[model samples]
Target chain A: MSAGALPPRVRIVEVGPRDGLQNECVALGIDDRLTLIDRLADAGLRDIEAGAFVSPKRVPNMAGSGELMQRLPRRAGVSYPCLVPNDTGLDAALAAGCTDIALFAAVSETFSQRNTACSIAESMDRLSAVARRALDAGVRVRGYLSCVIGCPYEGAVESRKVADMAARLIDMGCYEVSLGDTTGIGTPAQIAALIDTVAAQVAVTRLAGHFHDTWGMGAANVWAALQRGVTVFDASVGGLGGCPFAPGASGNVATEDLVYMLDGAGIETGIDLRALVDTARWISARLDRAPASRVARAFPPTPER
Target chain B: MSAGALPPRVRIVEVGPRDGLQNECVALGIDDRLTLIDRLADAGLRDIEAGAFVSPKRVPNMAGSGELMQRLPRRAGVSYPCLVPNDTGLDAALAAGCTDIALFAAVSETFSQRNTACSIAESMDRLSAVARRALDAGVRVRGYLSCVIGCPYEGAVESRKVADMAARLIDMGCYEVSLGDTTGIGTPAQIAALIDTVAAQVAVTRLAGHFHDTWGMGAANVWAALQRGVTVFDASVGGLGGCPFAPGASGNVATEDLVYMLDGAGIETGIDLRALVDTARWISARLDRAPASRVARAFPPTPER
Candidate 1:
């Protein structure tokens, strides 16, 4: 650590509109999801994950990502980010004319096999092409590493592997990488140690935390990461994402809750929590179930037309 | 700080058997609830909250608390604590032959009014009487102070007020005091500051953290409390409590999840996490909705019985 260097103020990447709601059985229209994004941008989030471009057959909730991105207001300060699983998804993202595309790879073999049907090396090899294509097209690329802390099947991932994989993503031309506790299996100490180890190999600012609340340690891990100099976090709005280890294993950390924490701490995330809550309600009503995020469930107010 | 003194270890007061299932809209039989408590004790939670001795009309979910207490297995090493809201509830718990009983008091005027239909001062006075009676009956008393950090009606509570409440509970001869973030508005810094202030007037061991995951900082707050030498935590089995203020607000952190983190950190929670998950599933199935606890929902084993 630099002597007396001021820690970088954390920036939260709101993934609620995208990764959060994507796995729900809910079927939200394109407009409602986009409005949610617009509200999030207006609320203060500079980087808002719009949606993921994927197969509706697999992720029906994310089927409207392309349309949602096109209709989005594209607020002056807000950056609309979308996820692309592989080269095919990246092509869809670029076709939609998104300048910023995110690629995902799992750190745990079990999760990678379950989510992508590939090994870690194989998944990265596929995402490398996506990153390269996006970079060539003059687009920004971010990397997501899932299950960096604990895997549902394997459990207690080694920190060294996480750091090595994060370094590899950076070397592959990704602008930033988010380390995810996909199963919500990390303690503050484990998170601090992972960040410390990964920071040794990559710039601390390039690393972010993607924590699930399965074990209710999502925000705690984020706090530990921030203390270790991580400045970026990925949170789902109303904690929309469900655990693919099967939904309900551990849900995503609700974006509203994360913003509340950041706002209370005097951190600069530029996100309006009230706006996020409105988005959560709109999508939740469509799903015919409650918003999975704890904060959205706690604070529900109708949005003004 | 004593150089050679070992840092204080946090204690897990599993509230699943009592608090978790008590507020559910569904009605569960007494034997099922007793079985749940027995399983929790087997999982190694030394302080297992057995049941709540309240009016059946008010909290129908807890109608059979007295019978549940009478039916649950008596383990020599474990303390089966039951919740007593007033003198009548205390007598009911004593009639059931419970050795340990807990008393409830809310800090927020609004919460106390809604929860007990009385002023905070009035509730405290009643709890004091119950505490005195419990002491005379040779029953251990644990005091609960809800809305310690923030309230739904009134936001941003004072730490000194929480300290004062803890002092009163202790002064009334309670063995320990549990401070709750009932509405889940507290952050890590705020929690640390609150615990530090409370610890100044009372012994740290006597203080416990009971945080709701409504805003996703429950576990983080618990971590903060752990750092402050608070060894006791009050957690529900399936994240089953709700905030009356914010309709549908999440309840306390899930017990299985807490056990996972504590176990991972080498903290001795004395819980067999797999067993806890089973109990959570069994209770949830009977409730007609899967347990709200993410960990339990994620890892439900098909209970053969």
Candidate 2:
């Protein structure tokens, strides 16, 4: 938070099960999704995005999210969050006994229309209704602001628009807002400007960075965000998820790689790096792909030497 | 150079022809090496590590450094620097008409012994001789300090030792020193500490960051160094080179990716990104492997869209 000082510890929101698997070509079974959440908890992640309440026809891989929430092993400190787009999704999440839900919105008008089939204001209205209903049921709600940095349809996003959207989400009773670089086209300068603009209106503690590694700038952007006093991040295990807009681009920043850098920087993440590495390896094996995590690929567990 | 400001213009030392191709499983011919150098020059990279004068048996891929140098088209503004380990290598490099040479040493004692077949002190002595002779012969000598952050054999490296080695290299009449994370195991904190310590002993203007992307922290580390006044970076085209000590790891930061970040950040690199992207695609196709560069993979040149 101070000049050249990092937070003592940061919270990692594991989105491998929801944000990650939702984009994968392989349709993982409900059991696999449950196991992934369980492994993330065992690896000391307290915030895990378990699944999303979306149309099965649209996202077949996340079809059994409700089922996953029902059978997921409950941990003491871990909270499983599910994405709920509207009142219908919220009702399904509540029926499945979900305790935490996330509302997704886009700051760019074009992206808002393209992604959610509505303008930014209309999407916000829907999200506000879902947030209000979820809060009435004593369910904690988080918000995801996509295209906060760049949009595929639109070139660059305004920082003022991002700040206003985040403030609106917080006013709607969302606990935290995760800024998503959906196109992964952000550089450090843009990240600094965005964080600075948003921090002026909202506390840095309430902001989260969800960067993709499409151009290998994820860690750099994360560093920029940290310098601006943001302490929460969204990462996917084995770096699952690809940018549908930008072909051949990578997905979210790998949790293992993020944890490795955080730990090496002497920042406490309350994460078991080895255990997280194991989880990454496990899921990557199940996906029949080499672990997309650079740390997992470079530093596999070695016997005493 | 300042606390949070990046340099307006940075120098990119392209090492793809030598550092990159040398580690490739495919052995490119002398003509191909010349073509790679010319292509890099055409892409607006003035500084290029053209070849290294090493043992033919040890690195057959770079065995024809002399012939490649002889046939390389002489560009007025572009300089091809060769890696010269000792007096013998210096002699070969001089015979090849190299005007610029680089001498490498390791700060970690174990890495020095393993990589150069000598102790740290002995390796420095050899490098000192090469630097002195090259300087007297009107050749610009650059120093490379490897294992400045982490060593595969020795584990964590101390910043003080790295600073001392860099000071010794500068004292030996080397024009500049490129601090290298040979194992690619450095984090931002370590990068800041190393650069700060080294800056105390040597002018920050004379320091360069040569980070590998083995663990995907290359861009972040580079950003840290940039914050601390590093103005030059060593990157491989198509992300070539591999650490023999660290298996299954990536090579130097990809030149295209680095340039893309710099350009996006409003920094001047004097490179035509589209031309560089074409070079990466051209070379990658020759190797029959996808370009390891994230930017090249994501944003290929497209006709008016």
DockQ of each: 0.39, 0.61
- Interface RMSD for model 2 amounts to 2.6
Regions of model 2 farther than 4 Å from truth? A1-4, A243-247, A302-305, B1-4, B243-247, B303-305
Candidate 1 runs further than 4 Å off: A1-9, A16-18, A21-36, A51-73, A84-96, A108-137, A150-156, A243-251, A303-305, B1-9, B52-73, B85-95, B109-133, B152-155, B242-249, B300-305
Per-candidate Cα lDDT values, in order, are 0.78, 0.88
* TM-score of candidate 1 versus the correct structure, residues matched by position: 0.85
Q: With candidate 2 superimposed using the best TM-score fit, by how many Å does residue A274's alpha carbon deviate from the native?
A: 1.1
- DockQ score of the complex predicted as candidate 1: 0.39
Best by DockQ: 2
Clashes of each: 18, 0
Which window of ten consecutive residues has the lowest lDDT sum in model 1 chain B? B1-10
Grade the docking of candidate 2.
medium
